[model samples]
Target: MHAHIALDGPAGTLRVTGAGLPAVELVRAPGTPADAHTPIGTRRAALLTLTVDGAPAVIRPARGRLLRRSYRVDVRVGGHRYRLVPCSYGESRLSRDGRRIGTLESSGDGRVSDAWDAGPTPLDLAVGTALAAAFGTGAAPWWETVGDIVGELVAP
Candidate 1:
């Protein structure tokens, strides 16, 4: 998949397009936190609406509280759930039930590179590409880390 994100407007939007998979656009919610600064470095997150071929699929967090060395996010499309976690060198691995399916890489620009070793469901590609867009946004505010810790403490 090839992805592009628009960050200059009032809302951050990510669009992904590729062969076989329907085009997807993830629009970040107005109040969703998009970046955070941790003790290690910077991280990013977003609550986004996933749209495939102009049809809405789901609204979910594309990335979660992360440390400098590692990142993880839970994503669900249709009834299938997956996790996108940091692997190495700005790359993220997409897995389902502990089995690897695809890998995503961001160019640090607005572009993203993605590949799947096997056939992937559309929702899978949509969520994975959206998460990659969130990662491309860089970091959140340093104070956001405080909220992250507090959120983690209260979350069950």
Candidate 2:
């Protein structure tokens, strides 16, 4: 079986709705101060927090190298860690333990589709969808942009 959910509205006031689940509205939390010593291009340089349902969840750039053109972010909720990686054409891959469990597509009306057996719970789906919407495709981190600029400058 497959489950589908729709995400609507902007980042601060996004709404998530789907079958068999209550509609949830995610509110973007205020920006947290970044560590003064953490340099740009590091994971701690950029962070986002959202109020999922009623609980607060922090979203941070995941460590490690970038996946081609995609950027990754990590979030923990209900003691479960989830990663959201934005793919080409406005689709974000939602995974846990390196296994893809769901996908969030941002084309037209935003939607999240997942395999029922391997996918996250409805609450998780909502959280993942919200995170994907907040950090959609084509939004590269500052570090990646800096690297691109340096690469172009060095190329023959």
Candidate 3:
């Protein structure tokens, strides 16, 4: 019950598609604030607020400024904060209050791997997958996250 999400075409705009989720459109058309619009995807509700910090990419030139951005995605749902911090190359650790919850790992072909424990509910899984997209890994399918969560819950 893992999710494998990959980015299609080039960079700049967030467009992703995977198993159980539809194609996610992260930003609005063009000439809009990167964080102005909400992310739209299959089973993409219950996500209260999604904020992004640190450029996930190495160098992103914005507004005449060449900034080195690291992906720091903060997702909030029902007052719980789920943070994704870049731990190393091709890997981001998702945690809550310094405790590990899950991990979003990037593969060689730009696909993102999402895995979590049984503690998180379906809503949590939804937000976590969104966090991956919001950060930069691209959007994963909804069923993948849900399946993983259910599997963990059923595991011994």
Question: TM-score rank, highest first?
Answer: 1, 2, 3
Residue-level lDDT of model 2, residues 1-156, one tens digit each, is 233434333323456566754354444334443332112212442333355556766667654344523367777665667787765444667776566777766442444443323646776667666655544533445567679989999999
For candidate 2, give the lDDT. 0.53
lDDT minimum window of 10 residues, candidate 1: 36-45
lDDT (CA) per prediction = 0.58, 0.53, 0.44
Candidate 1's displacement at residue 84, Å, is: 0.9
Off by over 4 Å in 2: 1-11, 22-47, 62-70, 87-89, 107-120, 138-156
Model 3 residue 83 lDDT score: 66
TM-score of 2: 0.54
Backbone steric clashes in candidate 3, count: 1
lDDT of 3 by residue, 15-93 (tens): 4444443333333233323332222221122322222232121111111111112345554445566666655545667
Q: Single out the weakest 10-residue window by summed lDDT for candidate 3.
A: 59-68
Best by the TM-score measure: 1
Once superposed on the true structure, which residue ranges of model 3 sit more than 4 Å away at CA?
Answer: 1-30, 33-70, 107-111, 117-119, 137-156
The C-alpha RMSD of each candidate to the native structure, in angstroms, is: 8.3, 7.1, 16.1
Better structure of 1 and 3 per TM-score = 1
